[model samples]
Target: MTKRIFRAVFLVSALALAVGLAFLMVVLYQFFGGQLETELKNEASYLSIAVENDGAKALEELPEHAERVTLISKDGDVLFDNRADASEMENHAEREEIREARERGYGQAVRTSNTLAEKTVYYALRLENGDVLRISSTQYTVAALLGGLLQPVLLVLIMVLILSGIFASRASKKIVKPLNELDLDDPEANETYDEVAPLLGKIRNQQRTIQQQLSAAKRQQQEFSIITENMSEGLLVIDKQTDLLSFNSSALRILGAKAAPQNQSVLTLNRSEPFRRTIDAVLAGGHRTELLQVQDGFCQLIANPVLRRGEVAGAVLLLVDVTERIQRENLRREFTANVSHELKTPLTSISGFAEIIQDGFVKQEDIKKFAGKIFDEAQRLIVLVGDVIKISQLDEGCLPYEEEEVDLFQAAGEILQRLHDPAQERGVSLHLEGGHIIHQTVKPILEEILYNLCENGIKYNREGGSVTVTVRRGEDGAEISVKDTGIGIPKPQQERIFERFYRVDKSHSKEVGGTGLGLSIVKHGAAYLGAGVSVHSEPGQGSEFILAWRGKK
Candidate 1:
C-alpha cells in the first residue's frame, strides 16, 4: 500500500509540473509574439513615412537594425530589400500582408521560419504614392522557449517527486498503524478508527462465537477420551481412506502397538491376515468378524462399516479377548464325552449281572452273588450320578447354601470321622490337629470340600500311612491343610489333578471304588466359597492340599 501510494503521488506531481511548464511556455510565447508584431507595425509606419518623404534614399541612410525592411511597387515588383538583393527577391505583390495593405490601408501576418526555431512577424502599410512598405521581425516559438527551460523544470520535478514519495510513505504508515497494533483477541477493547468500528465489533462477536465452539469441542473430546480410555474392549475408528482416525488405549494394547497409530494407515497397526481382511471388508461396506491370534491367546475382531447419508464413510472395529471363552467351550465338550463313558461303564456292569440271572445262565447258588454284584454296580452308578449333579450345580452357581461362621477344626474332625471307616478298611490312620479356628464361610460348601479332600487322601494312601487335617488362622485368612502319606502325584501332572475324572492310576482307581470327581468337586467348591486351593507333592513322599480364605475385614 505504501509503495502504491508513493508511486501515485510521485507520478501525479511530475505530471502537474510538466503540464504547468507547457502552459507557461505557450502563454509566454504568445505574449512575446504579440509584442514583437506591434513593434514591427510601428517600425513599418516610421519606415513608410521615411520612404515617402526621402523616396529611395531612406533605405541607404537608415542606421543598422535587426528588422528586415522591404520596398514594393503597386505593380507587384520588389523595389528594394534590406537583407537581400532586390532583383533576387520574390515578387511582393502576391504577399498576403501587401495584398491586405493595398485594400485595407494596413495589414500584419505571422509566419514561422522553416530554417530556424523562430517565426517571422510582418507589418505592411500602403503608402499614398501607390507603393507598399513592409517591416518583419523574428520571435522564438513556444518549443524554443520550453527547450530553454527544460533543465530547471526537470530539477523542480525531481524535488517534487522525492517530497511526494516521502509524504506518501508517512501517510500510508499513519493510516495503517492502528490496524497493525489492534488487539484482535480483545477486539472491542481497541480504540481505533470509528469508520471501522462496525468491523471491529463484528470481529469481537466472531471471536466470542469461535471461543464457544472451541470450548464445546474440547468438552466432547474429553468425554470421548474418558469413555474410550476406560473401556476393557479395544475400539478403533477409521476413515474411508483406511487412515486411522481415533483409537483407545485398549486398541493399542490389543493390537500390540507400541506407539500411537493415529492418522496412519490401519495396516501399520497390525499386518496380520485376519486383521487386514476384516478392515478391508468393513471399508467395502461389509460387516465382518475374524479371529486373530495375539501372542499366546486369541482375540475376536468385529468390524462394522460406519455409514453417512447411506454411503460408506469409514469403519469401527471392536476387539474382544476370547481366550477364556474358547477354553471353556473345549472343557465343556471334553466333560460331555467323559460323562458318557463313565455312566456307560457302571450301567454295563449292572446290566451284565442282571442279564446273567434273567437268562438263567447262573446256578441257583450263584444267584445271590450275582444280585450282590448288581447292587454294588448300582451303588457306583448312584455315586457317579450324584457327583455329576454336584459339579453341574457348582458350575451353574445355583447352590442354596448361605454364609455362616463355622468351626474349621470341628469341620475337619467331622469330615475325618465320616471317612474313618474307609480309612480303617484301607489300613490308613486319620488324625485331626490345629486350633478350633472359626472362619466365616458357607458350611455346606466347606464340608463338601473337606470330605472330598479327606476321602481322596485315605483312598490313595499306602497301608499304615497317616492322613492329617490341620486348621489354623493365617496372616490374611483362615487356612485348612489336608496332608496325606500317599502314592504322591508326579510334579508334571500336579496341575491337572483337580480336573474332573482324572486319575493317576486307572486300575487303582477302580479298586478304590470312587467316581474320580472328588478333587474336581473340591476345586469348584473352594472357588465358589472364595478360597484358594493348592497342592504340593512328590512321587514317594506325601501330598498336601491347602485351602485358604481371606480374613473378614
Candidate 2:
C-alpha cells in the first residue's frame, strides 16, 4: 500500500514537472519572438529616419554599432555600411523586405547571415531621396538588450517548478484522501467524503455483490464437504496439478492412504500404482473420466477444469468409490448374459429336436422321447419368460394387486400346497404353521410372493431338507418366514441375491429349472406394497427369509 501511494505521487510529480517546463518554454518563445520584435521595430524605424536626414556617411560614422546602419540603392546595391565593405555584402534584391522597401516604402524580415553564421533582423525603409536604408541587428544584440528580462524568466521557471511540485503533492493528496476515507470501518463514514460519494456508493454496492458471491461459494463448499464426508462411497478432489487439494475420510480409507494430511498432496498420499496414471492425465489437462485402482477396489475419477475469466485456473477431479457401482454394472451385464444363455438353451434344444424331426433324422423308435424333451424345454421357456415379465412388470409398477384382507394361514397353506409336489419329489419335507389375519395387498400379486419363496426354499434344499413356512402376527404388521435347510448363501453374495438373474450356482439352478428372477420380483413387490424384507443366514447354517407386511395406518 505504501509503495502504491508513493508510486502515484511520483507519477503526478513527473507530469507536473513536464507541464511546468512546457509552460516556461511558451513564455520564453512569446517574450523573445513578440516583445523583442516590437522593440527592434521601433528602434529600426527611428534609426532609419536619422540616417535619411543625416546622410549615409554620417549614419555609418555615428556609432560603428552592431545595431548597424547601411544605405542601399533603389535596386538593392549596397552604398554604405557601418562595419563591412559595401561591395562584399550579398545581393538583397531577391529579399522580400528589401523589395518591399523599394516598392512600398518600408519592410522588415529576419534571416540567417551568410557571412556570420548568426541570425539577424533587417528593417528597410525608402529614403526621401530614393535610396534605401537597411538597418541590421544580430540576435545576440537583441539578447543583450533584453538581458534584464533573463533573470525574471529564470526566476519564474524556478518558481514554477517548486510551486508545481507543491501543488501536485497537495492536489494528489486531496484526490487520494477520499480513497483513504473509503477504507474506514464505519460504513456511514463513507458518505461524509462527498467529493467521491457516487464512486463510493458504487464501490459499496459492488462490495455487497462480492459478499453475496462469497456467501454462495461458502454454502456450496459446505454442501460439497457434507456429501464427500457422509457418503458411503469415497470421494476426492484433485487440482489441475493432480495434487490432492481435498478429500473426505472415505477417500483416505478407500485409498488406504496414511500420508494425506491437511496440506499434503495426492502424490504424497500413498500414491500406489493405480492413482499415478490418473494423476498424470489430470496434470496433462486431459478432460475425461479416468478409472484407477486403489487398494483392491475400483476408483472412477472424472477430471474437469476450473475456468476463471475464460482461462483455466485449475482442474477439479471427482473420485467416486465405484467398487460397488462397478460391481453393480458387472452384475447387470452378467445378468443379461445369463438370462440370454438360459433362454437360448431351451430354444436351442427345441430347435434342434424340431429340425431332426423335420429332416426325418429321428428314428421312429426314439421320436416319442425327442417329443417329450422338446415339450419340457418349451415348458421351461414358458416359465423363464413368465418370470422375466413378472419382474419387469414389478419394476415398472405395472403389476396389479387386490388389496382385500386375506387370512395369513390360508395364504401360506395355498403357497405351500403349490410347492408340496416339487418338495416331495426332492425328498424335502414341507411344513406350514400360521396364526394371523393380516390386511395386505393380495390376490394375483400376494399369492405369487408366497409361492416363489416356498418354491425357492424347497428347490435350493438338500435331499430330505425341511422347509418350515410360518405366518404370524406382530405388534403392528404381519410376519412370514421361509426357513430353508438349503446350501446357505455366502456373506458377500447375500446382498445381491435378490437382484435379477442372480443364482447361487448356475448349473444347479438350471437343473432345478429356476428362472433366477423370482426373488427379485418378490423383493420389488414387497417394496411396492410398502412392506419390509430381511434375511438371516450363515455360510454352513440354513437361511431365513422374512417379510413383514405394513399394517393399515
Off by over 4 Å in 2: 1-260, 269-274, 277-286, 294-299, 307-313, 320-325, 361-366, 395-406, 424-429, 460-465, 474-477, 485-511, 527-532, 535-542, 549-553
Scored against the true structure, residue 174 in model 1 reaches a CA lDDT of 82
Q: Model 1: per-residue lDDT, tens digit, 1-553?
A: 6566667766776678778867887787778777888788888878877888889789877667758888889987889888889999778788899999999998888789766788788898899998988888877767776678789977877787788777777877887788788899888789989998999989989989999999999999999899999998999889999898888888888778888765789889888888888888998999999999887677899999999999999999999888788878878888888999999997998898888889999999999998888888899899999999999999999999888988889988988888889999989999888999877789998999999899889888999999999998778888999999999999989989889899988898988879889999999999999998999999979899999987652
RMSD of each: 5.4, 12.7
Highest lDDT: give the candidate number.
1
User: Residue 66 CA error for candidate 2 (Å)?
Assistant: 64
lDDT of 2 by residue, 96-135 (tens): 7888887788878878755555677778788788887777
Instruction: Give per-residue lDDT, candidate 1, residue 382.
Output: 93
What range of 10 consecutive residues in model 1 has the weakest lDDT sum? 1-10
